[model samples]
Target chain A: EPEVTQTPSHQVTQMGQEVILRCVPISNHLYFYWYRQILGQKVEFLVSFYNNEISEKSEIFDDQFSVERPDGSNFTLKIRSTKLEDSAMYFCASSVKGAITEAFFGQGTRLTVV
Target chain B: AQTVTQSQPEMSVQEAETVTLSCTYDTSESNYYLFWYKQPPSRQMILVIRQEAYKQQNATENRFSVNFQKAAKSFSLKISDSQLGDTAMYFCAFMKVMNYGGSQGNLIFGKGTKLSVKP
Candidate 1:
């Protein structure tokens, strides 16, 4: 089965540095999303992208965070000046449709900011 | 806004036994989707099962099944004949159906229940 693939299974960055997480969603999927899960916490939705633009975002998705589908096949999330609290597992997911269709999740990129 | 709640923080069941993980949600939308995702030690999120709010009949996938009560807004997952591989963190998620402007609604997940299958 086709699955979402994320780059850099693990990343360690210093505080105040920038980090970019990459994801290759299923080719046919149109809806893409970025979710965050702090250690020992529930997964929280950060943002959803469709039609090459952000469709919706949660309160946690502040100005520091940005997502782009630069080449139609690769979706990327960039964080400007990472904070210590930003350390968590970031998941990339994609789905054919929103409601009934299930979202396929990547193995996740564990970002650890020191 | 939709919220999913998984009351049990941790649960354990003997191998070959049956266990149920509880989940409830608060949503005013009549059309929505509920799902149970399992994350093993590898931390890979795997889809265990899913239930549609409009479906009255429960959905079953092999040894995994769901008891979906749309009226009560309750969706629970039951694992029968559990095995050692069943040990994982199970999350309950809720998603609302919205097709306006080709935007699919985001998923709201609960805290998750850590299930351990003992030998």
Candidate 2:
């Protein structure tokens, strides 16, 4: 089975520094999403991308956070200025259609902001 | 807005016993989807089961099954003959359908219930 893949398993950056998390969604998937889990907290939705554009985003997704499908396979989440609270596990997921369809998730990238 | 809630913070079961994780949601949309995802120690999200709101019959997959109540907005997961390998954090989520055919919808997840199966 095809699985989502994320690069830089772990990222440690200082506050105010820019960080970009990359992921390769399932080859045939058309919908992509980004979610974050703060240490010992509930998973929070950030944004969803489809047809090469953002379809929906949660309040947590702000100007500092942006997503891009720069290439067919590469989907990225860029944080313009990281904050201490940004330290968490960032997961990238892809689904063929939407919720009705199973969404496959990557191992996740642990981003640590100091 | 949609919100999913998993009341149990933790649950345990004997290796050969069964376990049930509870999940409930608040949504006005008649058409939506409910899902159960498991995150192990590795923190990888694994799809455990799913049920459509319109389906009155519960969905079952191997040892996993779901009791979806569209009227009550309740979706609970049942894992029978549980094993140590079933230890993980289980999350309940809700998603509503959008414009496109199965267009991606935002997910609202519960705090999650941690399950530990002992041998």
Error of 2 at B22 (Å): 0.8
Residues A18-108, candidate 1: write the lDDT tens digits: 9999999999998999999999999999999988999889999999999999999999999999999999999999999664677889999
lDDT of 1 by residue, B72-100 (tens): 88999999999999999999999887645
Off by over 4 Å in 2: B99-101
Clashes of each: 0, 0
Question: Which parts of model 1 have CA positions greater than 4 angstroms off?
Answer: B99-103
DockQ of prediction 2: 0.78
Worst 10 residues of 2 chain B by lDDT: B97-106
lDDT of 2 at A20: 98
Q: Output the lDDT of residue B114, model 2.
A: 97
Model 2: per-residue Cα lDDT over B1-119, one tens digit each: 78888999999999989888999899888777788999999888999888877778899999999988787888999999998889999999888877464746577899999999999
